[model samples]
Target: MDRYVSVKDIEQAALSLLPKGARDYYKSGATDEQTLAENKLAFQRLRIRPKCLVGVERCDLRTRALGSEVSMPVGISPTAMQRMAHPEGELANARAAQEAGTIFTLSTIATSSIEEVAKAAPTATKWFQLYIYNDREVTRNLVRRAEIAGFKAIALTVDTPLFGIRRADVRNKFTLPPHLRLANFDGHLSTKIQSTDGGSGLNKYVENLFDKSLTWDEVKWLKSITSLPIIAKGVLRGDDAVKAIEAGCSAILVSNHGARQLDGVPASIEALPEIVEAVKGYNVEVYLDGGVLTGTDVFKAIALGAKMVFVGRPALWGLTVGGQAGVKRMLDIFRTELEYTLQIAGTPTIADITRDMVRHESAYSKL
Candidate 1:
């Protein structure tokens, strides 16, 4: 922790420490990985136009997401099989988010059960990330369990009709270790992944178990089944965002499934502006989560109209490096950097960050 000064350092450390299979599974994106690289590159293309001598003194990073007050505008996004990164897994992530006064989302395919996370971090603001299963009962059961466990919302993933072609997983024959099971499911569904399956076992799992013919009706169905707010995750287009809202989604997560579901889609940041414009005048909140690595990235997304931004891999990197402590450190890093950004950028609070403060690098060329 003392030696690692940045998220990249932590990521490199985790990659060095993790086994080849788990390492590739966590790092690799879809075929060609064009969107994967673009998520970060897009952020770099945006420049912050800082204000000078605005009498900056204190900077506040507090904000609200999904009706809950958070310490900062950054939250944890769901990533599967976190136990591969650390022994404490989702439990550690929940605890870290709790301590940071932020939100933690548990993946549908998590290594820890919904009940386990609730009991472990009883006060954490938790959301359950869900996928509609081919068996409606399975999906229903997961939602019911999440609601019963005190999860605050349902982040319904709508992007992965089929898993993308991650070449790394295919070559590594990535499968969950024998010791860990998908804690939310029972029987074969819990431990379905096998190295003998030839290609990526997780890909095959989604192909066989997840619903492919889902429509906007499923969003209504999800709302019907639970009183929890439905956050439509993986929306990239304004039309889709509008459709999600019309179908009763309470929020839109502007994402391309972390560039894991498709090879050549817009980065979450790049897709954000259109969705924001489309959702204007709606009560629903919009969030982004594909590639957020630093404080400036968070500021840029907020300026572009994301109510909040989330990090998936950065949290994993923290968990891998030092479990709960590592995750907390990672969050602290973001919080501190964001505070500096707020003060230096002449915005003393989250609300002060506006679209005018961020400019595309191309904007300078015309001048």
Candidate 2:
């Protein structure tokens, strides 16, 4: 465990250990992946302002997210196909989140079924990520299953109308390993990923199965079917955030599908301020997830008004490196870093982290 002290270390080990098909599929982003690189690069451009001589002692990292008390502002974002990284898969990821006292979001296309994960981490604060399917019954059934399984909220993914053009997946002809299935769906739907002449099999599966003609009305329709709070994921613009709030989303996740769905969008952190400002006084929580690699990255997002931040690849990297223990270690790294950040930066509590604590690097050039 000491050998892998950082998330990047785990990521390197994970990438090296995974098979070519799954490796490329997990790492690659849309088209040229410009946004992928920018997500982290954007964070680097922000500078944190530290304060001193405040008699700082103990720093608290606990906060409330989605009406639940989390150990910290960090949570695990939904990333598909965990079994590709390890044999335990989503089960390991969920258990780690439970141990860390944070939330774990299960993807609609997870390798583990809703019931299986619920039983695995019955006490974990779990949320289910949903993708509206072309088949309305499939969508309803998924929501029902998640509700019955004790998932706390529905993170409705609104970004992926169609899968992005990830060149690596196409080149690798990405398909799930024979042993794994998209466990939530039935027989053929679960096993749809296969090498196709058209390119990435997963892309084809989404195109054929996902609903593309969705509009804001879909949110209302979803609300009608289930009582779980909806979180509008993949929002980048302020207008969309307002619309999400207006259409009854209790929270907004500012993301660009981890830069996998689109290439030219802003980093999730870069897009956080607008959404945060837009949703002010709306009784909505705004979270960001993209290139959150370190505790400073988490601090910057919170200072900029993000209610919480999530990590997708980093958690997967942990899972790949050591399954549940690896994920727990990865989270502990963030927790420790965040605690140190609070104490050193002179913001001893989550509320002390304000907009003034962070400044864009470009802002200093004006002086």
Candidate 3:
């Protein structure tokens, strides 16, 4: 724990330990990786205006999200495969989420299934990420399984239209190692579907599975099948956030799929203010999931009107480093930094984080 002081420190250590293909796939985002780089750079564009002599004391990081009291406004984002990084995979992630008293999302492309993860970490707050497939029953079955397994919500990711323009996976010819398997569909699909022509392994998988015709109508169909609240992920604009509410979604995760789905679009943080302005009066809660790496980043998002912020690559990096313990350490470190930031930033309670704490960089025309 003393050795890994920064997120980059843990990431570098994990990359050194994992196999070449696995490391590259886990670290690399879409083509040219401009968006991934922009995700971090977006945070740099914000400046925190800490109040002086505010008498901040006894900081409380706890907040309510989706009608549940989470220890913090941070949740684990869904990534494709985790076992590739560590044998424990999503289970380790689940354990960390449970220990932190936060929500953890399981990807549809996860190496571990919902039931398996639920069994592994029963007390963890679970949310399943759904990528609508061509097979309607497959989609229904997944939702049904999650509902039965006690997952609190369904985070339906709608941004990826047949995966991203990830050139790294194409050249690397990335495929799951022999040891790793998609536990949910292993026995169901005899041969794996690979879309190598336009993209590669991932593109092939996206084509074979991702149902392109999916629309807001499907959200209703899904709602009819389960009692869980639907969270629309991958939103970057205010209109879409409003539509999600109109579609009966209880929450909307403001993201660009960790800047993995689209290139040259605005970063998650940059898009936050607009969406917050659009849905300020709506009962819907707003959440974010990109470029979040520090406790201050969480505080900044809260100031910018985000109810909670999700961490994507960092948690996976933890899983890559030392499985469950590594993930827990990552969360713990962030918690420590966040408490430290809140005290120094003069915020004594989560409610004290106001819009004035954030100063948009663009307001200053240095140019």
Candidate 4:
């Protein structure tokens, strides 16, 4: 733990701690994983052009999202079955997010129930991540329960009409452990995800239950059901970003579902600038997730116009290492690195981070 100074270090530690099946599920991406690898590489392809001689004073990392102030612009993205990483699961994650003063987005498929997580971290600024099920009533019920639990917003993931073909899961025949269940749907849905002899049980569960017909009209219908702001996640194309705003989404998250949904999509960061351009003056906040691993990555995303950045695998790595404490440490590293980056870049605050501060390395290649 003392030796884990970077997110990558924490990832290696977590991989060592998690079971083979659980680890594969958490780490593997779709088909060939080209998008997954590119998501991280995309960040490196951009070069930061810093300003100098600005009065170096105190740096402020505070930013607002969905009408609430968070200590930093980094938030935890929703991931399912966290107990596979640590016993405390989403409970640890929620507490850490609250303590860090950032948002914690809970998955619709989390091991901890909405009521249970709310009970565990009553004051955490929570956002519920929705996966629209085949039954409209089930989806409605989940949204209502999240509202009742005091979640601040709804991040509706739109990319996964069906689960991606993650070969590792298929090969491993991955299934939720018998001890765990999708706690959110205890009686209302099938909590148990049974293993198939040949393929991933989770994939079968999603195919059987998730509604493939979801479209822009469904987004509008969701808005009618919840007073909380809706954030459309997994949008990569500029056109799709516009449609989300037209459908009354309060924000758009430029993501490729962490490259777990599509193997060939552009990296989320690469998609951010275009989406930001598309939604210009639309009163909609833009955010990004997928392969964000460092403060530099967070800073770069904001420079390109993301209001905030979300991390999924990093938080799970933290939880796997030391539960809540480990998760907090992971966030602390981000904060510390971000503050250093701000100082060196001569950007004193979040607003000071500007588009000119970064250029895609390709722009320099022709020079």
Candidate 5:
């Protein structure tokens, strides 16, 4: 509705619109959902130390990622089976991102094919999120297709060697509705995701198709195969961030798979500073996702050294509510809030968002 001014409002609308099974599959995290709750909560725990008496008339949110100029530091993270939420699915999402001048990452399991999304938003800056399937040829073909279709980068998701145990999906026996298939696979591979008697069909699909033995060497191989920059998503630990750089990754996405693949991992925000510190000398850039729902969250993320902050569920929520226009509204809200935040914090430009602008609440509580 037009009254929906915030992401939470859109999220409520989406939850109300989607079926129980699809809603839960989209919203629920891994076993226990501890990290899931913590992801957002951690942002609340971070206190912003705003400055005063500084002229903040103009605020610029534009930033560059992987050499592409985006209107803002906030971008869309890849989420699967979007048609379950909206008819246009990834196509709408891509168009929305293009309209907002931000990057749109399409999931490997997206309901729309690479060529379809490319055709839908030819000028959009897109990154293809890759799940290294067991079949190397299949994975290579996906990369080749993305490059051919003009996707700028490859975001290799490393956390999901196997799918997480989401109880909601298990209880609902989540499977793609009979009508929807993984459009990316279409004729190139089996589009069918077999329904399971119990548990999520997705978990079974991932378990059977994903390469469990994936290693850093695989990252090297990915670089060798494609000229597009590779971004290693799901990196939390500082050591792992360093290793990703060593593996020839151009960027590191500090994520916990939206807390979907693990029960108790540090929130992406909490893990960001250390990763930023670890990658100091390296040329790699760091981005963050998981629990970035507001412009304040984006501001905090940039202050904490993330070049950009991504939102997965929020984008889906927007898509569910009103297709491309809804997604555009969601991004506009973030941009507006972030501008207000920058004005209040005395930071006029993205580069002005320094570490002193934010502090962990715990640091203050200790005193």
Candidate 6:
């Protein structure tokens, strides 16, 4: 473990540490995993065309997102049941983000309570990830609670009205560990639907709570609940990007749910430039999160019009290995690799990164 090779190796190590069912649930992405493969392939398709001899020495990777400054243009994407990998769960993640001077997002389905995590990293940039439940009062209460706890933003996940076609989840009939609970819902969730077992127990909650009747007007409802800026997650189409912006979203995160919620959708990286173009002007910011595995991957996404990038599964992998320390180690590896990559590519600073560095196979970087 001391001599690190690649993020894939770290992932494989994490896989070895978990039970078969847990591994399947975390590692497999949607039906046939086509988009899962494409998320990584899209990055490969991007070729960096470097500019040389510019007297490059100092490299600046810091940037801003949602009016909050970031030490680097990256944040942790919301992932459920972090405790399944490590007992400390979201707290470890929050501390890691605090140490890195970036944002940490807590999933609606997270095992740790929002207040608990807020206490864990009191000064870090915190965002509460939301998935509207069938229960309106529940959603409103959670929003109010997040605001009361001083979370800076609210990110509504939109792409997964239905769970992805992941065969492994079905094969395993997964259930949340007995000690864990969806801490955000606490006493708010319906007990009648709590008896089911399959997918993440969180998914059963999803089936019960997700509003089938939710519409564009709902975004305004969320705004009225609390004054925190709303950042919509899961926009892959230009039309959807425009819709999110018009609905008064502060930022549009171009994600395919890390290619875990859909099998055929374009990679988030592939969809970024179009969304960035479609949502032009009007103070809208864009971010990307699917299939990013390295520091070079982060640099590439920013060059392709992503205001910031989110690292999803790799963060989980690092947590599985050594809690906060492993998370720190993994991010350090990516940062070092990216710094080396930027220097070698002759683009020393993040601003030096541009679309010319990437060559698209089609109009898209990778489908």
lDDT of 1 by residue, 264-295 (tens): 89989999999999999999999999889989
Off by over 4 Å in 6: 188-202, 361-367
Worst 10 residues of 4 by lDDT: 186-195
**1-367 in candidate 4: lDDT tens per residue?**
6677999999998998899999999999999999999999999998988899998778999999988999999999999999999988999999999999999999999999999999988988999999998889999999999999899999999998999999999999998887888998856354547456579988878877899988999999998999999999999889999999999999999999989987899999999999999999899999999999999999999999999999999999999999998999999999989999999999999999999999999999999
Q: On residues 1-367, what C-alpha lDDT tens digit does candidate 5 reach at each position?
A: 5678899999999999999989999999999999999999999999999989899888899999999999999999999999999999999999999999999999999999999999999999999999998889999999999999999999999888898899999998888887788988855344446477678888877767899999999999999999999999999999998888899999999999999998889999999999999999999889999999888999999999999999999999999999999999999999999999999989999999999899999898889
Winner on lDDT between 3 and 6 is: 3
lDDT of 6 by residue, 292-359 (tens): 88887888898889989988788888888888877777777777777887887788778888878766
Q: TM-score of model 2 relative to the true fold?
A: 0.99
- Residue 344 CA error for candidate 4 (Å)? 0.1
Give the TM-score of each candidate.
0.99, 0.99, 0.96, 0.98, 0.98, 0.94
- Cα deviation of 128, candidate 3, in Å: 0.7
* Best of the two (2, 6) by TM-score: 2
Q: Please report the TM-score between candidate 1 and the true structure.
A: 0.99
Q: Estimate candidate 4's alpha-carbon lDDT, on a 0 to 1 scale.
A: 0.93
Listed per candidate, the RMSD to the true structure in angstroms reads: 0.8, 0.8, 1.8, 1.0, 1.1, 2.6
Cα-based RMSD of candidate 6: 2.6
- C-alpha local distance difference test of each model: 0.93, 0.93, 0.85, 0.93, 0.93, 0.82
